[model samples]
Target: MAQLLVTGGAGYIGSHLVLDLLLAGHDVVVVDDLSTGHHLALTRVAELAGRGCRFVHADIADVATVASALDGVDAVFHLAAFKLVTESMVAPERYFRNNVAGTAALLEAMVRAGVTRLVYSSSAAVYGPQPDAPISEDAQLNPESPYGVSKAQGETMLSWMCARRGWAATSLRYFNPVGTHHSGRIGQPQRDAAALAPRVLNALQHADQPLTVYGTDWPTPDGTCLRDYIHIADLNRAHLLALQVLLPGQHGIFNVGSGRPHSVREVLASCRRVTGREVPTTDGPRRDGDMARSTADASRFHAATGFIATGTLDDMLASAWTWAAHNPAGYAT
Candidate 1:
């Protein structure tokens, strides 16, 4: 069994990945600062998997601590970072310090520990507002927000590491990730999430809080922004596939998405249909750095690794609704 390290194991996506790795017979260690992650998520993940993973409460920017956590780790899954676009725009320096500088420190620690295999969790935000319907990997990265810029810079660092350092790495540029695990025991436990799916679920659970439909005048089918929403399960599977197929001295960047564009209104309709509840929404002006449409061309990853996203919009909403209905107050409930 391989010993693996996940940088943000207490967060939503990282928890799922840690469980997946544990079930696959790998020894996993999670290093998290808990700045925005929940310890309860990892607790529940251990309960569900019938085994426990080693948890080290630390930050990736701490090269000394991260170097210690990399002990015997065969590979690393880098997922810890501040993800809110609005927050990053307000404080660009924070994103640069945490996402960019922190990543540099982690790479240094990995090299010190003699571990080179890495799978970076990138974002489609790196593409900003592309004119193409399905953006390919070849598209020029013109990130609008500081958060996006930080991710693009991370990929650039990985490219250099692979070219000169002989590191085997893959950067999976994810679109909007929605849905919860099928068991509903672990999901998006954060309450103030900025993602549309979590915000919709939160609105459905509260009578006084109505979901804000941002940018109702966008140039899309329903005058709302269109995005490629992939199921969390599908997104995690892509990571496992990449981890399994990573070759020595090889580097690749692939897009992990559903390749189907679902607009904001479409998502609301699906939530209403799946939950059998009226989704209350109020139209609002567009948020800064918000894109009109962002879809993915996932054919490159599919051809390279035979990985395809198989979840529909309704399927994603149904799973997320199950989690929200079960845990209205999140893990605290």
Candidate 2:
């Protein structure tokens, strides 16, 4: 079994990925700042995996701390970043400092510790509003928000690092990650969630609050934003596959998505079908950096690794509903 270090192993995706790695019989050491992550999620991961992983409560930018965490590690999965588009528009500096500078620091720490393998958690926002339905990796990266730019910048840094330092790095440009594990042990934290799925689910929990459908006049079939939503399980599995196939002196960038577009209204409808409850929504103006349509043509990744996202919209909603129903306060309970 390989020894791995996940930089953000307590967040929604990180927690799930750590669980998968542990179940796959890898020794994992998670280093997270707990800025947007929960310690409880790691606790639950340990419980579900029937094994415990080492946790270092520190930031990835902390070179000394992260270097120490990298001791005896084989590779690193970098998933620690600020991901809110709206927030990034208002506070671009924070996104650059944390996502870009922080990534540079992490890479430096990796070099110091002599662990070269890396799997970066990138985002679909790098594509921005594309006229095309599904965008490929070769598409021009005109990121609309600072958050997207930061992710793209992280990928750029990885490419240079791979070329100069002989690091094997893979960047997975993720689409909207929905759903939860089948066990319902961990899921998105509902409080202050920026994503539509968790916000919609949180609205369902609170009968008085209505889910806000941002920008009903977008250039889409349903007049709402179209997104490529992938199940959390499928996304994590892709990470595992990417980790296994990483090669030295090479850098790979792939889009990880369901390769299908679903509108905001469609997602709400699916939530209703899964929960058998009314999803009250109010129309709102589009937030800055919001995309009209962003799907993924992940054929390249499929050709290279044979990994395809296998979760339908209904399946994603059902798994999310199960997790929300089980963990109302999201690890607080």
Candidate 3:
């Protein structure tokens, strides 16, 4: 019953959220610059859901355009940002201007439009390197990379806005988001993608390109990086839950993950089990800004939003393989 606006509605997570909203009988509007997002994503989500949503081609940094998109919007899911850690480290100015300052502009626009609720897409990268297996939400936030720092700053900005305006805001600090929609209609590499999820899918999309297992010397069960991989569908559902549960004059931070750590080798083995193919693999040194292990402590999110992630590791791998096999070219079909 609410009219929602998503800032990066043409990207992976954003597009899925748009579909979820529309299918729930809510009005949805999207604004995306098409810089790294594909407009075809919105088109396909509309087709699959059998419901149409409006999309405006614009950047979030542009206040006027953002204000226009906020017309009649009751809340927003702000997911627009450049997400590559290496890229962010190299060009931090872009990250600051786009992720941090762009969010500032969006908040100003929302205030002007009297839109007072938001679900901010944050990252667990903001937690930086942790020695422990599963880090709690209350743990110190010492983000090492510029990307993480930018997201942390965005959270601060959102807090200020909520304090001053009585806006309902929930900053979902996402762990690793993997896999795709169960439908396979919308997933993977609509554009150039980095990180483990896309890299794995891209390797499969291209013929026999070896999946690189980064950092094989960590002190873990397998010596590979341990991550909290949450299925994108579960993560998307939590957003809906957060949006519906949050009311005005409230603000909080919550972690989104499976709450269990899965090693890179396990993920690769799962990929093989799902696809029944021997995916090529290689070992490499750890990339910059990566931790040995990081998982979410989901107690807070469960108590607050009543969102429980039920998808298993096999389910994540299977859904990812399904989408990759069908749409190797991602919406080019």
Model 2 per-residue lDDT tens digits across residues 69-139 = 89999999999998888899899999999999999999989989999999999998888877676899999
Candidate 1 C-alpha lDDT tens digits along 131-248: 7879999998889999999999999999899889989999999998988888898888647568988889888888788999989999887999989999998998999999966777
**Whole-structure CA lDDT of model 1:** 0.91
lDDT, candidates in the order shown: 0.91, 0.91, 0.85
Q: Report, for all candidates in order, the number of backbone clashes.
A: 0, 0, 0
Judge candidate 3 against the unseen true structure and give its global Cα lDDT, from 0 to 1: 0.85
Question: In model 3, what is the error at residue 171, expressed in angstroms?
Answer: 0.3
Prediction 2 global C-alpha lDDT: 0.91
lDDT of 1 at 53: 94
How accurate locally is residue 310 in candidate 2, as Cα lDDT from 0 to 100?
92
Tell how far residue 6 is off in model 1, in angstroms: 0.4
RMSD to the true structure for each prediction, in A, is: 1.3, 1.4, 1.6
Relative to the unseen true structure, what is the C-alpha lDDT of residue 109 in candidate 1, on a scale of 0 to 100? 97
Using all chains and alpha carbons, the TM-scores for the candidates as numbered come to: 0.96, 0.96, 0.95
